[model samples]
Every structure is written in C-alpha cells, then in structure tokens.
Target: MCGGEQGCIETVKAALQGGVACIQLRAPGWKKRRLLELANALLALTRPAKVPFLLDDEVDVALACGADGVHVGQRDLPVQTVRDLMGPGALIGLSASNSAQIQQADVAAADYLGVGPVFATQTKTDAAPVLSPEGLATLKALTEKPIVAIGGINHANIGVVAATGVSAAAVVSAICGQPNPLASTQQLAAAWQAGVK
Candidate 1:
C-alpha cells in the first residue's frame, strides 16, 4: 500500500474502494517494530477487501505481518533468499530496471517482476534510469513472468504502460498525494482496463 500525509491505511482503503487490485506498504525508514505495526494494520483492511497487502523490501516485517507478499529491490536480499525465508507459498517480487538485470535475476523463484522507472520520477530518490516505454516493451518481450510497472506511473501514462501487457502498475503520489484518491484510483484503473482491452 502507498503511504501519505493523509495516512497509508486510509490511502489504501480509498484506493481499494476505487478498485485497486493490491496494496504495498512502503515505509523503508521506519523501525522494525513500527513497521510491523503498520503492516498488520494494513493487512486487516486488505484481508477484508480481498486485496493483497505487500511490504516493500523488508522480509522480516512481511513475514511478521503475514503480508501476502514482499517486493524487493535489486540491492536488497536475493529472491531465492526471500523465497527460502518465506517458504514456497508467499508471493515475492523483484525489481529489474534493464535487460541485463532482468536476465540476471532469479526469475524462476519470483512470482513477478517490478519493472520500471517507466518514466522519470522523484518518488524514489535512487530509482534506476527511466525505462521509457520502449525499454518496457523490450523487457516484456523477454519474459513470461508477471510484470508490474512502477515509477512515474500516473493517469497520464498508465495506459501506455498497461499497453505493454504488464500485469499491473504500482503508483504512489498519483493516488496518495491526490486530494481525491478514489477518483484518481478509478481513473487510473479505468485507463489500465482500456489499455489492456
């Protein structure tokens, strides 16, 4: 789930109501105990809504919360390590910015790949180089694993990203920073639906 000044639990709830398929709680700077508290709170809402609750880059917090999954970056623990710690049933996502990284990842152990900076973004200060639409298409052509495009994803470019046949798109400010998250989520979701059709 996305976090915000308005609060992540509320942000996720509004997005879910607007038809978001999943939520990833991403508070990397938080302490483990605090992170666990937030993750559990997120799980409560996601569970009832039938939406998956994922933790960003913290396997321990994810396991402690019994989060449906965990999304890790390239520098984080390896996908196989996470899988071993998570066992075989939990969902595991790994980030890949380019073809080299994609070819190098332990894809067989991952359930999906978080592919992007589809556009330049300030959300993640250290985000990899922008993987323009063409880059995304190239990656898509090279893989059969599910891809969820992230970074600079908003209503403006969501359709283009979805057109690459990505299984999903992860957004932050587009929903969390908006004044009306529900409408924003609905618009993004609709754009994605239209793109896939």
Candidate 2:
C-alpha cells in the first residue's frame, strides 16, 4: 500500500511515533526487489522502536529483510506451513473472516488472528463482507488466540472496535492516505484507548 501521495516510510514513521503497536507491510502487487527494499527500510524504523514488522503474503521477502514475520490470507500459504518456514521465533498472523474459517484455522501455529472487514472497506477490492462489532465479538468468542480486527477501521468507529475486546485493530486508509498520518494515528490510538476504557 505504498506509493500513495505521501510515501509509506514517512507514514510508518509517523504511525510509530503515534504509538502504533505493530506494523504490517501490505504492498500487494510490487516486484520482489522493491518489496524487499521497502521491507528493509521499514525494519530499520520498526526494529529500533521495538515494533514488530510483518510482510503481507511475501515470505521470501520477509525472510530476506529479516522482518518479524508475515501475514497470510486464507488463499495464501497455510498457517502450519508458514510456521514451519518461519520457525518458532517468528510471529505469524492468519486472516479468518468468519466462523467456519476461524474454526478451520490452525490457531496453534499462528501468533494471532486477523478477523474482519469488520465494516465496509475500499482498501481491498475482494474484502469479505462486513463483520461489524457484534460479528467481531462473536468471532472472538470462538477462539482463544488474540484477535486483530481488520478492514474499515477508522478513528470514528475504532472505539467500538476496541470495546469489542479485540487485541488490536488493523487500519489502512485512515492513516495511509491522510494529510497527517501521525495526527490521524494519534487520534485513532486515543480513540482506541477511550473505547477500551
């Protein structure tokens, strides 16, 4: 999701400064060399900040860049396969959109579960149906693994997301294309905190 009006690195730096808990690099169509370059640069920032950096669907690039791990979708590599490749120390994340997917997921292998399009999202053209806060809560009850709510999360609705007792929220457009990613991230973080309270 780089190559926006503002560069991805700068946006990441701002989000880190704004207290983003983790960073997932999710550039879908870029070439491997370019993806590796961005991953390395992002690692430079995330590593020093003690933030976990993850690549989306690019295990080779992640390994090359020494990223913390990779996030895989259902159609991507299997969770056990990813764990086997990344080994025990690497943090693996899996996306499961509904109860059936969640039940079928190999929770033992993944460090966490990314569940959503909790609302309508334009970020992913093929994103799942909207889960809403209630759907997220229902999905949460289905698994013991930490849930990171994804899709359509923004400052306006992040409070309800946080109030769902999810372990985290994965935001894209809210910060990525914004005028001030740092300020936007700060507001989202504050909203998440307020929602948690």
Candidate 3:
C-alpha cells in the first residue's frame, strides 16, 4: 500500500492476508485520477476484509474512496484542516520525526503519528535523519497517539521497533519488493507480536 508502482496491489493483498491492521496508499508519483482509481480498488478489496484503508497527502481521493484515514506530513495539509475536511470519525495521521515535533504536533486532531525513519530508508529519498532507539524511546514518552514506526523497517528489525512500545510499523519495500511478499509480511507481523508481553 506504500508504493503505487508495479506490484503494489499484490503486495497489499499479501499483507492483508498476513494480518496487517491497516494499509495506507502513499505513492505520489501517480496522477491524481490514477491514484483515485487505485484508492477505489483498494477500498473495494479492504472493505469486505474489514481492514482500514488510508491515503497519504490526498484528501480528495481519500474522501472519494471513503478511506478510513489520511496521513499528512508536516508540510502537507494541516491536521486541523484535514479534520475539518474529513469530519469526525475519519482517522487523520501526521508524520513526525522526533519528540519535539511530536509534542508540538496538534495530536488532538490526529488519530496517530508516523514516527520514523527509525532507520535510514530509501523509500523516501528526502527523509530526515534516522531516529535511533533512544530517540524512539524519547518519542514514546511524549505522546499516546498510536506511534507507527516507518522507514527502513522489515522482518529483521521490526521487533526492536515495536519493543519501543509503538503500536504499529508501516512497511514499504520490505514487502512491496520482496520475492515472497506473504512470507515476509507474516514474519514482520510476527515480529510485531513478539514485542508484546
């Protein structure tokens, strides 16, 4: 659900089958109309499965597909503005790079926060510096918003991230570009569960 490039749909299907709680479509390379089409199709696929669908940086498409949420970066739509547009009940998430930003964020308007790149990642070439474990620990103490770790996350290191007490991990290339997406997704999901008592 991260990459709208080739193999994205299949990757999403595999993750859903492997028990991802939510999926956010975050590709910005596609045209608005095309993204809308993909959002609609993903909504159809996820609606019956009871999985929540989220959109990144595109409120119109999110609204068009009746998506469960929309993730807006700090530079993108303001959370308050998005809250106004989506109304109550629709989830709105914000991207945060550190504890200061997390604390400063009007989290009252957001349902969650995308906290990363926990490790350096190529998924977003312009991503800020990677947040070390200590940084994650700091952020964890700052807020109760379900902190969803993203960037450079995978089966190999997801458990460590989850152990920081974050609620979820948002994956991209790890599942999207894998030779065995379903197995990888299962492994990552299990890693997340391993963090629990």
lDDT top scorer: 2
Q: Backbone clashes in each candidate structure, one number apiece?
A: 3, 1, 0
Per-residue CA lDDT of candidate 3, range 109-177, in tens? 999899988988887988989987668878878897888888898888888888888888898888887
Q: What is the C-alpha RMSD of each candidate to the true structure, in Å?
A: 1.7, 1.4, 1.7
Predicted candidate 1 versus true structure: per-residue lDDT over 1-197, tens digit per residue: 34432377788889999999888888867889988987888788899999888888999988888998888888898999999998898889999998877888487799999998999988889989898988998998888889999999999889999888789999988998888899999999998888884
RMSD of 3: 1.7
Per-residue lDDT of model 2, residues 4-72, tens digit only:
423988999999999999999887878999888888888989999999999999999988989999899
Off by over 4 Å in 1: 1-6
Order the candidate numbers by lDDT, best to worst: 2, 1, 3
Off by over 4 Å in 2: 1-6
Q: Tell how far residue 67 is off in model 2, in angstroms.
A: 0.5
Model 2 residue 26 lDDT?
A: 86
Estimate every model's Cα lDDT from 0 to 1. Answer: 0.87, 0.91, 0.85
